[model samples]
Target: MVVTFDVSPEKEGSVLNYFYRQLTQTPAEVRGIDLGGKTAIVTGSNVGIGLECSRQLLDLGLSKLVLAVRNVSKGQAAATELSKDINLNPGTIEVWELDYASYDSICSFVERTKGLERLDIVILNAGIMATEARINPSTGHEETIQINYLSTALLAILLLPVVKSKRPLAEQPGRITITSSDTAAWAKLDERNEEPLLSSFDKPGKVDMLNRTFVSKLLGQLFLVELAKRVPSSVAVINMATPMMVYDSEINRETARSLMGKIVEVFRRRIGYTAAVGARMVVDAAVKHGEETHGQYLGLQKLKPMAPIVYSSEGDHLRSVLWRETLEEFSFAGVEDILNEVNSDRKEIL
Candidate 1:
């Protein structure tokens, strides 16, 4: 039984240490699996663990890499730096615009990647946290809910046709690895409060509504598990939960200059896991072949059971509801129609 907390350095330290030990010992051996013949798409790869994951995957020799970023310039800069480090071939890495906050961007990315020979890995790594008010983008969603969960769900559904197409039913399956957080266990999905999430500081007089981080995280996992079930045996969906606070490119350094921020930074340094360490779970999940680990939510590098809340019948029901509402909110009816076309095309070709 794992004890859950709000935001404690002590609890965070314990989780970070457990993962560091596990990651530090894994040697840099590229399993004979070559990604050159296949394709991989990673969101939010411009920085943080996403970038590290992309770099490591490239290190393993991928045929093609698509970095889905909102800012093409930043994406290009990051790609240049990474290429310089590992001698990146210009043909290997391609940058595409994908703002998870926008449904149109999701559709465009999906249409663009449909041209891949086979998508071996699709990583949903980009996420955001609202420190002030919960602002869902123009799409009218809680900003966190939209980008972190709904957008990813839409993208996954859009890409499912491609994932299910190139692979046979009884062989090594494709993979969908969603980057989740330990914070998800903090809150259970509340149907009554289906209101869009407010930015952290947007509340005029609201205090209790300020902290639903746990609820959001839990719901995110629930959504992934449901998607896994919906497309079972064809695609392996693994939720990578990092127990520790991670040190990533996204950490705001200027904010850390304040006395309070500096003090907080000290504790973060003492306990936060590095991007490389946090990335092992995703890499392991992505490369694990066969159907044995399909539809399982793994923590760190092992296939462990999800938090108890994720397994509850009530939780699953909420997940279904959220999924439906998310589609409606994101105006994703077109996704289903598009997948129908892809499947139809396959049938016609056969």
Candidate 2:
């Protein structure tokens, strides 16, 4: 399995700039903001950056906050813990179950969103860092790819309509932000030329464990490139906000027991930003700025392109390939019809 990053001039330069910002830039904080009437939902809110993002939203006076987790009981537990830190009005925060690993769970969560009266911001922060490749029993895709890319795409597609219709039509459009990473620039993506690209990702032997999350994040950026073309910023603003590399965020919980994880943790505490500080970027993406940032990458809270390769002719070909295969993968759920409806509803965007 491939374990090392593909070294190149592009990767070297990008990584260097990223590290410089990480070392020199001051951590971001969302201030002078108020969400008194807005409602927001965050996945993976039980711990790490998600939890702190939820906290910041509530502190800003978000009327309703939903912590969508895989386990309702644990989500409730998290909600309780959140309540103790700050005063929470009755029903201010709600716990909803959403498991990214299961297609049914994601679909059901979307269905539940129909009951909400308002949805101003959605931060899709739930993802895993895998140290090895494994297949999801419910969905046949590799675990990391399934959770971070495919299922995230499915949920984002389904939620776009809900966000569009329920938006309060404030000064700006509703936002759907995904937590992306700088590591995406390092993926080799040898599978780009495969006829059935997703299947190639499913082969455990074909994927390197270390690069799995990076591959998933890159796939997400590729999907977004195609998505923005079909669904315009007017319909709903969507973008990727990467915090670069955050330590003490516990996003790598999957590898917590491994020797590599321990070493990474030591350095993370020494060099990486705290989860609270890292989450400000996620909330910043959701609340600050407007249409200019739509369908773009917010690297360390700055507008940036996805990857050097995403602009190449080869990247263009791969984008079309990924779109076709991704839709086919979810055809059983009428995903194509869902996207077509989104496109048709936003015909004014054209």
Candidate 3:
């Protein structure tokens, strides 16, 4: 599992600078891409970048779009708004209920997808950033960790076969676009123990809420590394996209209420891309296809090298440990059988 690259200090620093630049960069305009007759599912599509992504997809001619949201009422409102705004044809958009905090909800969402004749794209866009540590009652993990990392991973793995099965009918290979963040580069997880990192949150003051968010995103990148290895290229292509700093979203609002949060918000407002611009990165990652993008991290609408730690020996170890512990968490939540069946299917296909 030692993936080596000859990265020089100068090159690494340059990449770091490029990522910093993305905080202020205006995303390139997406154009000329046709998604006609294609079907896409976007989680958390009720607002923010997810909603913008759904709008863009519909405008680009996707035949069927599912807006998966925790609030079905809001999702229905979004669907209605999008249909009118885009002057969408009747029945082009549908809303479904999904609450990542609940394992049953995730299962129900996946089961519903089985009814689709073909699923061309899956955007794992639902996530949260908590300013305080709180445990999810159902998962017994920190709220951010459960929603952003664990649940997102569970849903992505379950949908692998559904997307893969449609590859043959797809104009191009099906895609699973993971919405990650540059903040993942800031996470520093303890590597000495076998216990899942999020479990440590139960101890008082052990987990920094912001740092937990970083770790959750880092876990997402790690999951993609393992996922790319297990599935065939033709079956599915998984990649992570960093929207950088998106302003005016609910996540940003959570960070903007405190004094320190206010200062950070000012800096973000001075440089960060608008929610619409950030959504372009997600849309490009979803509709664009290429071998180079598989298992890669994309930023500002282009494939960029991940944080240096992601390629280091320590990173390889973390990836392995995270993958194993993640499955264990899923098992505790009663998805071990599903995990085994998916892996068995992937092996047969590969």
Model 2 residue 257 lDDT score: 75
Candidate 1, residues 123-146, lDDT tens digits: the string is: 888876544335554765566566
lDDT of 3 by residue, 9-45 (tens): 2363253664567654777767888888889999999
**Whose TM-score is greatest here?**
2
Clashes of each: 15, 0, 0
**Candidate 1 whole-model C-alpha lDDT, 0 to 1:** 0.64
- Tens-place lDDT per residue, model 2, 8-59, is 3265338677787788885568888889988999999998889989999998
Q: What is the descending TM-score order?
A: 2, 3, 1
Error of 3 at 297 (Å): 0.8
Better of 2 and 3 by TM-score: 2
TM-score of 2: 0.93
Per-model CA lDDT versus the true structure: 0.64, 0.83, 0.79
Better of 1 and 2 by lDDT: 2
